[model samples]
Target: MLLLSLFVQPATKTQAATDLGLTVDAAILIDASTGKILYEQNGYESLGVASMSKMITEYILLDAIKAGDISWDQKYQVTDYTYAISQKRALSNVPLREDGSYTIRELYEAMAIYSANAATVAIAETIAGSEKAFLELMGKKVESLGITDYTFVNSTGLNNKDLQGYHPEGTAEDGENMMSAASIALIAYHLLKEHPDVLDTAKVTEKTFREGTSDAIVMKNWNFMLPGLIYEYEGVDGLKTGTTDFAGHSFTGTAVRNDQRLIAVVMKAVDANGEGSYKARFDATKKLFDYGFTQFSEQEVLPAGFVVEGNESIDVIKGKADTVNIATAEAISLMTTKDDVAKFTPTLFLDEEALEAGVEKGTVVGKIVLEHAEGKDYGFIEGGDLTVDVVTTENVERAGGISLFFAGVGSFFKNLWGGVTDFVGGIF
Candidate 1:
C-alpha cells in the first residue's frame, strides 16, 4: 500500500498555464474544502465589489444570530433612515413602511435576495444600533479573517452618493465598497463553511418578502447562474451579484457537484470594449466552473497506513525483534487534472541512526516528500512539494544481555565462516 499522510496548510494561490481569456479585470476559482486556488488572474487587486459585499453582511448577520446578539424571529422597527433609503428610486429596496415592523428574518431575506439597501440599514441598526457601529464590526471581522485589503464603508455595497447622509460613518475616500477578488472568495468560503443553511435562502428563485400584508413585496434573486435563470448552470445556488457605474458587474458564485464545492469570483467584468456588461461576469464565472469540473478532479494521492515499498521494515538494533514494520499514519488527497496525475512522485527519507531497544510504536522517525514533476509548459503543483511525517508501526523491546551476547557471537562466526570459504575457493 502507498504510505500516505494528510497535511493541512494555508491555501496558496499558484499561477498556472491555462488561460480562459476572461473579460473580467480580476477573477479567481477555489476549492471550497481544501481552499486550493485552482485559477486566478489579478485576484488580489482591490476594486469595487458592489453587492457582493452583501455576502459579508450576511456573514456578519449570521454570526450575530449565532452569538445570541440577534434572532431571526425578533422584530425590529423600521426607522425613518431606513424608510428614506427605500424611497430612493435609483436604489434596490423592498419599500419598508416607516411605521411598519418586520422580523429580522424578513429584513435579512430582503437584503440577501434583493440586495435592498434600506433592508440592510434596518438589519444593521437592529444589530449594532447604527450603520456606523455595524461598519466597524464589518471592519473588525475582515481583520479577524486575515484579509488585509478591504474597506467596508456601508452594509449594502451602495455608492457614497446613494448613502450620503444615511451612513454617518462616511465612506472610504473612494466611496464604494472595495475588496479584492481573492478576499471576496475567502469571505464566501467562510460563510458557506460556517452557515451552510444560508444556501436555503440563496437557492430560492422567487419569494414574497412581506407575505399577505398590505406592503407585500415580491423578491427575486439577481444571480443569473441560478436554476430557472436564463444562463442557469448546474449546481449553482445562493450567491450575490452587484453592478454600479463605478464597479461594473461583479459576481461571487458557488456550486456543488459530486460532493465537491467551488467558489468562483469575477470582479469588474466588462464587455470587449471595457464597458460594464451584466452578462460578462456571469459568463466568466460559468467558464471557470466548467474548467474546474471538467479539467480537475480530487484523487487520493496517498493511502492511510501505507507501507513504504522497500523500507517497510527497519532493523532494530539491540531489540528483541531483528526488525519492525512501519507505515504512514494518515492519507493524503490532492486535486489535480487527469493529465497532471502522472506527475505525482514520492520519495521516502528515514532517520540514519539505528533504531535502539525499547522503541515505542507511532514514533516519528522520518518523513516523505511528495511532489509533482513539472509538465512541459504548465506547473499545477504549487511550490512543487508537500511533506508528511512517517512513524513506526510497532514497538521493539530491548533484547536480554545473554540474547545480545549470543546474537553477536553468531554474527561473528557466520562472517568468519563466509571469509574462510571465500579464501579457500580463491586458493583452489
Candidate 2:
C-alpha cells in the first residue's frame, strides 16, 4: 500500500500553483471500470468543450470504419471550404490540397494525433455529406449514449466565427460548442470501453502527414502527458485536449496502473496567476489522477444472490407455493476506499405482476437500487442493469382447480361463522 502511494504521487512538484484547489472552471475524476465518480466540482455546469468535441467525431469515424460503411483507404475529396480551413496556420491543421486526394486513414491519423480541425470536417463530410447533417448524426449518437448536457454547434470545435462565411448554416456565427465536464468524462469512459484501439493513435507524440511530399507537414500531439512529453504522467495516453478563447485549456485524460483505469477532466484550467496554459491543465489532471489512484481502490462492494434480511421473499398468488425465494441477479463491485465499504446501501424493488403470476426460476421479479452518500452514481452512459437484478430462485406452478374450489369453500364458511359470532356478541 505504501509503495502504491509512493508510485502514484502527483507528478507536478509545485504546490503553490495548485494548493488553492483546482484552478479550473470545472473538473471530475471517474473510475472507468464502474461509471462511478470519485470527485467533481462544477462538473455538471455546461461550458465550452473546445477540441474535446472531436472525440465524438473520432468515435463516429471509428464506428463507421468498424461497420464497413467507410474504409480506412477510402479516398476523401477536398472541398474549397475545407481547403481554406486547412491552410489557416492560426488554427491547428495539416495542409490539404484541393487538387489532391487523401484517404480516410490519413485524415483520421491527422485528426486524432494532431487535432487537425479540417481533417475532422473532412470525416464529417464523408460520413454525413455536410457538417449540419453530421451534427444530426452526432445528436443521435449522444442521445443513444444517454448524454443530455451538451450543445454541439460545429464538428471541429472551432469557434463558428473562425469558419469564416463557410461555416455551416443554422449555428451562431460566434458560438463555441459546449458540454459539462462530467459529459466529457462520460464520453471518454465509453470511448475506452467501446473502442479501446483509439489509444493506438492518441498516444502518438509526433506524426507526419505525408513524408517527403509537397503537402508534407509534421504534426505533434496536443496531449502533452503521454510518456515522453513535457508534463508527462505515468500511464497517461488519451483522450483529447481543448483550448479556445472561451474554453481556455481543457483536457480529458485517462491512465491505467495496478489494473485500474481512471478518467479525469479539467475544464479551463489556469495557474496561480490565473493564466490559462498547457501546464495548468496537465497539473490539474495530475492532481485528480493522483487522488484517484492513491486514495481509492476497487473491491467487491456487493456480492451475487444477495437478499435483504426480513424482506427476502414476497407472497406468491394462486401458485402451488404461497411464497418464493429471490436473490440479486449478479454481484457488484465498485472503486472505493476501505472506509466507504460501510457506506453502501442496497434497496430492493419487486414487480407486482410477476408476483401475481406463476413464475419460473430465474425470472426477473425485482431489482436492487444501490446507493451511497459520497457521490451520485452515474452508473453507465447507456443504463445500469438492475443496479442488480432480483430474480426468483425457484419455479412456482399454478394450483389445481380442486385445490382452488376447496380453498374457496373454506373461505366462504369461515366468513359466515365469523358473521354469526359477531351477531350473538352484539345481542349480549
Candidate 3:
C-alpha cells in the first residue's frame, strides 16, 4: 500500500529531460506504486493497439472467474464462428476443433500465452454469448476507469478487414481496436494492481496446453523480456505483446527490482523502412526500465509519531497540564532522485491559538510542510511538496473549581504588582 497519506504534501513538478531517444510512435514509463509517470512521449495519441487488447479481455475474464460468474473448469464447445476466425492466416491462434470441448482455463491460457484469437472468441462467446457483447462489457469497464479515448471492435484485436463479416449485428465494419500509450499503461496498472495472481499465468515462459490429449498444443510466450528469452531482462514478468499491419510492434511490459515495480508501454515501434521492427519495441522497453531503476529510488520521508522540531508543544489554557506535545499521524514515503535528496527540507506549521481545557489527545493541532530548496537544474522540486497532520500527544483536563479560584487570584496579583513596579520606576 505504498500510497501517500492525504496529509502528506505532493512534490512540485520539476521537469528534467528524460532523453532516452526512443524510436516509437508512443511510449510511457510509470511507477506502479504511486502511479507516477516517470517518462512519456506521445502517450495520449490514439493508434491501433492490436492484440494488446487481449490484456483487457483477460481482465474481464479474470474478474468474472473471481465473482463466480464463470469457473475455470467450466467447458465450452467451439463453434463455426470461432473456427473460421482461427483459420485466418494473418492472425495468431490456437486451432480449435468444431467437435472439441475446452475448459475456461485452457482457453484462457491459450489466449494469454499464445495470443490465440480462437480461444479468446470461445471464452467471449461462452461468457457473453458473443464477442460483440463481451466488447460492450469491455467498453463499459473502460469508461468506468475514466479512460475516454478508445474503441474495441472485437475480442482478439484482429483488424476488421480480417474479421469483416464475423462481427455481431450493429457493430461498425470500419472499427479497429485503438488505444493510447497512456491508456494501455493505465489498464496494465489496474490489471496488475487488482489481480496480481495473473502474474502466475504471465510468468510462464513455456507450457503445454490441453496436455496429454491428442489435440495437445504447445505454447511459448512471445514476450522477449522473460528470463530464458534472447533479450532476457532481470526482474521482467508477465504482460502482453502486439503486432499488425496498422499497429506495428507494441508491448506492455512490467518488471520489479528491489520491491519497486514499473510498467512500460511502447507502441508502433518501427524500423527505418517504416516496417514493424520486432527488436525496436523490446529495445525501447528495456531502456525505459533501465532508466527508471537507475535514476530513481523510493525513500521514507516522514515517520509516524514524529514530533515537529520547533512546534512540538501547544499551551493548554485552564487545563491539568500547561501544554501538550504534538506529533504526526502517519508515515509517508516518495520516489526521489539523487538531486532531490540534496535539497530536501521540512517546515512545521502550528495553530495560532492555544488549546482549551478538556482537550483530548490525537486532536489536530497543526501540520508539517515538507519541502526542498530549488535546485540550479530546476527551479521547482522534482517531487511535489507534502503535508502531514500534527496531533496532540496527550490529553489536558480542566482544573478543579478550588484550583481555578487560586490560579485566578495569583494571576491578578502578579499583573497588579508588575504595573505598580513600572509606575514607581517611571517616577524615580
Candidate 4:
C-alpha cells in the first residue's frame, strides 16, 4: 500500500491562565524574559489604576532621556503651572515651590518611589510643555503597547478637576485611566527590559528630598514588597504602588530566583475596612512568587544529534548520495514536575516532503515536543519544546519546476506503456 504524506508547520504552545488563591480584584504572574504567563486571575479585568499610571509616564520620560531630548542633570524650573498643580492638596504632593527647581533625575525618583503627584506633573510639564500634552503622549505609548483598556486624564491621578470646583465638566471624571493586571505587568517588563537601571531607585526603601527645599520631606516607598520587609524574601525588588478611594491599592513587583525573574501585579485589592490596601497586594505578590519558584524545575529531554528514528535509512532523491543522516534540530528542555520526568513523551515534528529527491542539508524540517500529564500534581508540566533539522550526507541541486513537471508527465506515460507491454506479454 502506498502511504500519503502531508507536511504541516510547527505548532505554537498555547498559554493557559491558572487561578491562585488570591483575593485581590485582579492579579497575574509572568516570566519576565519569555513573556510567558505562569498564572493569572482576572488578569484582563480593568480597574482604576491610581498612581500606577505613573509607570507609563516614567516610561515616556525615560525614552526622551535616552534619545538625548533631555538629560538627568538638566534643571527644570518650577513654573506657576507646575506649582499650582502641586498645590492640589488632594494628591500625593512632593511640594515643588514656584521658585525652586529640580533635575530630571529627582523627578524620576519621586514619581517612582514616593508616588508624588507634584513630581509627576513637573516632569510632564518640563518634557511636553503641559501635563495635558504629556498625557497625550501617555495615550500614544499605551496604544503602541496594544493596551486597549487604559485611558489617561492627567499627569497625576487626583481625579477630575471638577472635584475641586475647578472645572465642572472635568468633574464627570472619564474612566480613561483604567488598566488591568496583565497590562501593568507587561509595562513593567518592558521598562525593565529596556532600562534595568530604573530598579535602582525604585528599590530604595527610604530617602529624603532636597532638605530645606520642601520642609525636609521624608520619602518612603509605599510598596510593602520591597526589601527590608519582615518576610525577608530574597531577590524581591521594588516597583510601584497606588491607592485611591476609587482605585483601591495596586502594586507591581519583581522577584528573582536561581536566574529566573518573575513579575507580578495586583490591582483593586481593598482591605475589609477599606484600608491597608498596599499590604494586601504585598501578600498576594509574595504568594505568587513563592508558589512559582518552589514547584517547577526545567528539564532537558533531547540533545542535539540524538537519534529519533533509527535502523532504517530514509531515501534522498536525486542527490550526490543516495541517503543521509537525520538528526534532532536542537536541544529540548521543559519546565515540569518530578513525576513528569518519568512519563514524558517527545513527539517528533518533521516534514516528509523535504526528505524527497532533492533536499538541502541542514535545513530545519520539524520540532519535538514533550507532552506532560495535565492537572493538579503535574498541571502545566510541559516537557519542553525542541526543534529537528535534517543533516543530508550529500547536496543535490534543486530541480526546476518546469523540468520536474515535464519529467513527471513523461514518467506517467512511460509507466502506462510498460503496463500495456506487460499485459501483451502475458497474453502471448
Query: Which one is best on TM-score?
Result: 2
- For model 3, what is the error of residue 27's alpha carbon versus the real structure, in angstroms, after optimal superposition? 1.6
Give one clash count per candidate, in the order shown.
0, 0, 11, 5
* Residue 175 shift from truth in candidate 4, angstroms: 3.8
Q: Per-residue lDDT of 59-130 in model 1, one digit per residue for the tens? A: 989999999989899998988888888887468888877788889999888888888888888888988889
Better-scoring candidate (TM-score), 3 or 4: 3
Clashing pairs in 1: none
Candidate 2 residues 140-249, lDDT tens each? 88877788878888998899999977778888889889999888888888888889999999999998889888778999999999989988899998889999999999
Predicted candidate 3 versus true structure: per-residue lDDT over 293-396, tens digit per residue: 99889867678998755556888899878888889888766666766664555666766468888988889877776665552222211133466888987888
Scored against the true structure, residue 412 in model 1 reaches a CA lDDT of 99
| Model 2 CA deviation exceeding 4 Å by range | 1-20, 212-214, 353-358, 373-386, 399-409
Task: For each candidate, give its TM-score against the true structure.
Answer: 0.82, 0.87, 0.80, 0.77
Q: lDDT (0-100) at residue 241 of candidate 2? A: 95
The CA lDDT of each predicted structure is 0.81, 0.84, 0.81, 0.68
Model 4 lDDT, residue 397, Cα: 63
Tell me how far the alpha carbon of residue 44 in candidate 2 is from the true structure, in angstroms, after superposition.
1.6
- CA RMSD, predictions in order: 6.0, 7.7, 5.6, 5.8
Worst 10 residues of 3 by lDDT: 375-384
Model 1: worst 10 consecutive residues (lDDT sum): 375-384
Off by over 4 Å in 3: 1-15, 272-274, 303-323, 342-389, 398-428
C-alpha lDDT of residue 299 in model 3: 68
CA shift of 10, model 1, Å: 18
